[model samples]
Target chain A: MADEKIKSPKIQATEQMKQLITEYYIDAKTTKLPEGSHKPICWITSGGPVEFLIAADVIPIYPENHGAMCGAARIAPGLAEVAEKMGFSRDLCSYARADIGGALTESGAIPGGLPKPDFLLCCNNICGTVVKWYEELARIFDVPMFLFDTPFIHVEKPEHATEYVRQQCLELVKFLEERTGSGFSLERFAEVAMLSVEAVDLWKGVLATAESRPSPFTCFDAFIHMAPIVTLRGTQKVVDYYKLLKKEMEDRVAQGVGAVHDEKYRLIWDNIPIWYEMRNLGNLFAENRACLVADTYTTAWAVDIRIEDPLTSMADAYTKVYLNISIDIMLEQLVELMERYEADGLVMHSNRSCKPYSLGQYDLSRAVAERTGKPSLIIEADMTDSRVYSEAQTRERVEAFIESL
Target chain B: MPVAGVDIGSLTAKAVVLQGREVLSTSLTQTGHNSRVAGRRALDMALDRMGLDEGSLGFIVATGYGRTAADFAGERITEITCHARGANRTHPEARTVIDLGGQDSKAIAIDERGKVLDFVMNDKCSAGTGRFLEVMASALEVELDDLGSLSLESTSPASISSVCTVFAESEVVSRVAEGAPKVDIIAGIHQAIASRIYAMAARIPTNEALIITGGVARNIGVVRALEQKFDTRIVVPEMPQHMGALGAAIIAGEHHE
Candidate 1:
């Protein structure tokens, strides 16, 4: 028994996606005017309107993604320490701390730091912290900063809210045009919007394949492969990549091959992942023959986007994101996900870095338990900072939850 | 067939042997630095007392923080599930369990069949745990066993605002410097732990039939404080620390089927 081997089946597409992301970064890093480059680089939030930026031929960069890389490399806390020493509150979001620390220190997991942003994009749809986080970057860099404010959705999407967000989408185009010294092209935007829509649809298809009994791929695989959808969503490459991923998942489902060797209980995860402990968590659940089939975090990439009237739809889509809604809406979504996936339980990550996501999880967990008659486990930890994690405590909670199931 | 259960906790290792529904023997020892050594020693002691060898046992189960480290048991289960099972086997009507171990505290809600329905645990901290009491005992220059009774003598317990063990120690030092009565300070520490546990326990749908288990349950001061805070009578088992091992043995007996 001691010699028994436990192996989590590797997703075949990750190796190719890793190479693809590396090349994409190298291209963004090496781009310069010396080589007759005219594309402007803009540092955007993860939930920013990247399709419009892509349509205007501007390169978009997500610092939050870089923060995840720093976490994986285990340099996030050291980098956050730099920012904290500079008087930034340790209570600030770790992603914000890591990004601010990386900017000031000009060093990170990637050599020479991220390419200097020609402009900045801020969206409050994800969290209010980004408003201050981006303001600091703008203060230091002295660049044009655009703020897209999407009010929280409480009961329903009011007409005034949609109108307000639609106006900002138009103003956003004008802001980008003025900064880049170019005019917005309707034809170009139509192509990019359609590609973005197709990419999102493919991503939805990829996640839906997990509804199979022994999921073809776990959410851990989705967390890694989700980069292209976040970074390259409005491009043809993203559409092509997801098509390949969806086909592979289809084959796995047909072959009855699961992410874990023996899949017993299927669980749905809420909130962002513990990036530093992904492999550890994956192995932990896999060892118990429990597969995390779906999660709320990665589903943000597939928010309903209408291509017919892309700008107006963008207004509603970006405003109604999971984090920007009320607990009632979140509970509704949780119930839908639970039924759709037939999950045995839910695991809520009470992330220290994300207040908006973690604030109402207790209520949400209770609601989920009542609605689905399934257990939900709340494990406290930070997404990027390993310092907040207690392995022994988390292990006991997870083991007991699995044993009860 | 006789079955054995071993619980290797952070601070103690306990073993229990059962023949049918009767507990044949039980043993407890400090876990020391090596949990596997402590586990073997405790289990051997219990088996020796019962005049039984390893070959006589039908199955063995392990539980607690050091459970996986033992590597000798046929199966491992978490203390949360085991505590509920063990409490149910003894009380038969226990719907809730509050377990305050050496390093962590948890509240488990169980159904009629001893199946865990819901639960909540303290954030990874020593607050509201046995370790917290030990630190306060040393800081106040009192014995760990005497802390409970000392607190009982105080009419006005000095207020302890800090729930963190480290901060609470410094607070105790400052109080001692201010010449506050030692009995009052000890009572305050128990109140703080009881309040913390009560708040965590409130998260689950608790019932009147509640059982408090683990090594800390032997502290009457904590039990009294919890009774005051929760306004409910608390039940303490005869061998509180052995519940996890006893539950595991109960499970081992069932494994034969």
Candidate 2:
């Protein structure tokens, strides 16, 4: 009884892709890439395999980056519906669902505008979501899946992990050398390893822009800018990108321009953003002259900590990252950031989409402000799905709070 | 013959003293770690506003995530029931209630007589909630009150993807990295939140007589974004944030009869 003229092309394309994923395209590994100059397409995480991929000239794509794109485009909703249709619960994190679902519905259930991968690489730095996501993708596509297994860190990383992951790094190098026509770039990597480290120093500087009384930018920008590091870390380009970003921040600060109206306060924000409303949130903050000084992402970058030699030091550092460890360690890191940034207060976001990250936030919030003498505020909401946010009420409470401060 | 209501939420409690349909007084504060302390604090604050005591002649009701936690109250009602009653009283024609609280966002459909029909709630993520805005507000160094007004000035907006509050922190940091304008980021957050709210309301049959309640209703910026998306006038009580509490008291009064 509905008008057929109103049908959407986007929906039609999705239907076509679902059919293709269900049918024709066989895993190409059964037949090798046309034995030419073309390199094997590789899937990369924020950490793992970046140096090795570049050494072998393998084209790299970060799945997390794709996941973000799906969210920004509101593509997560449809993909999430597809995942739910496949029996995944609606309550599952939409980021995870959209990533998997987008892959299924994208240009026929493949990464749209992306080359078919010859190999897949992921690490144990971030969360279990990445591992499971890659596992399913590998199973569906039938490609070689290589996991850069980093040992779990609770209190502190054990000494054995250093040698273990380092040896794995070397193994990674050999794997790439055999697959590609290029030789093992040992000296190049030693150089690349150190180069990657310096980028961190620059990244930290760029992040420092948030310290401005009226921060020139916001946390969402950092999330966008982190893509190059995920995709091009070892390459000189990633380092160059950070340098340029740092320069812009310096310029913003020098002009005395407020990211918000008259940044009279500095606050630290906890948790991820609601992708559905990143732009609006930032503008609202700018009008108040409040700037975010530090956040948890400063640690996510530890995923790609450069190893001095594919044999030592670097892998150990990667394994020790705050994210690879326990909440207690994250707490320690939180204390460090709050103190280092000299922030007046803390804003804790109790996000429902990611239960793990937000689980202990209330306790942590209490501890940070009570134990450390910093003012703390806790707000609850969802990050991706728009169904969760209430702007007017939030505005009222926060305004009164700031004025009170 | 004005009636009053008090709503105590998980994080904060509110008291909106109503005289008939007009708001006489309203107050807000943290709920503390325990709900009892929070509930008492809220009640006392409302009493203080009215220059009266707990031994008043009117009715009393309690509502919110911590409705049952309000042990001293004469009556208890679900936030849904309280919201319906309050919204109906605010705009007699309101067919829908969109209430965004500190921890949850809800969309309710009501019949012409203020009877509840269908409702949806997003209690899962902090991304689309006030918590998300609070985080970004802290990061941007902006006063919370100025957030809604300043965000309207930004020409360009930033895209924030992390649905988890934890990861969104990383995203906001990255925004700072790229030199994206702070106001733009805040504005984007408001839009993101509004989109979530509108989508939920759309799921159930809705009409122009929409009412918004909860503590977040005070944010003008969120109201603007929601208005643009819903494409209809939004009816909010003078003390929109305390409608839940007010409804609770009204219910208690009726029940006492």
A207, model 2: CA deviation in Å? 1.7
Count clashing pairs, candidate 2: 99
Question: Per-residue lDDT tens digits of candidate 2, residues A202-311?
Answer: 77787776766566655656665665555666666567667776777777778764444556667777876666666655555444445565677644674445353445
List of clashing residue pairs for candidate 1? none
Q: lDDT values of the candidates?
A: 0.91, 0.67
lDDT of 1 at A352: 92
Error of 1 at A312 (Å): 0.4
Query: Model 1, range A1-405, lDDT digits (tens) per residue?
Result: 211344555778888798878877887888767768646989999999899899998889889999999998889999999899999987899999999999988878779888888899999999999999999999878887999999999999999999999999999999989988889998999899899999999999999999998899888899999999998898998898899999999999999988877799999999888988988888889889899999999999897778788888989999999999999999998899989999999999999999999998988888888888998999999999888889988999999999989
Best by TM-score: 1
Task: List TM-score per model, in order.
Answer: 0.98, 0.58
Model 1 error, position A152 (Å) = 1.0
Q: Write the residue-wise lDDT of candidate 2 on B183-243 in tens digits.
A: 8887777777888788767655688888888767877778878888999878877877777
**What TM-score does structure 2 among the candidates reach?**
0.58
Q: Candidate 1, after superposition: displacement of residue B23 in Å?
A: 1.1
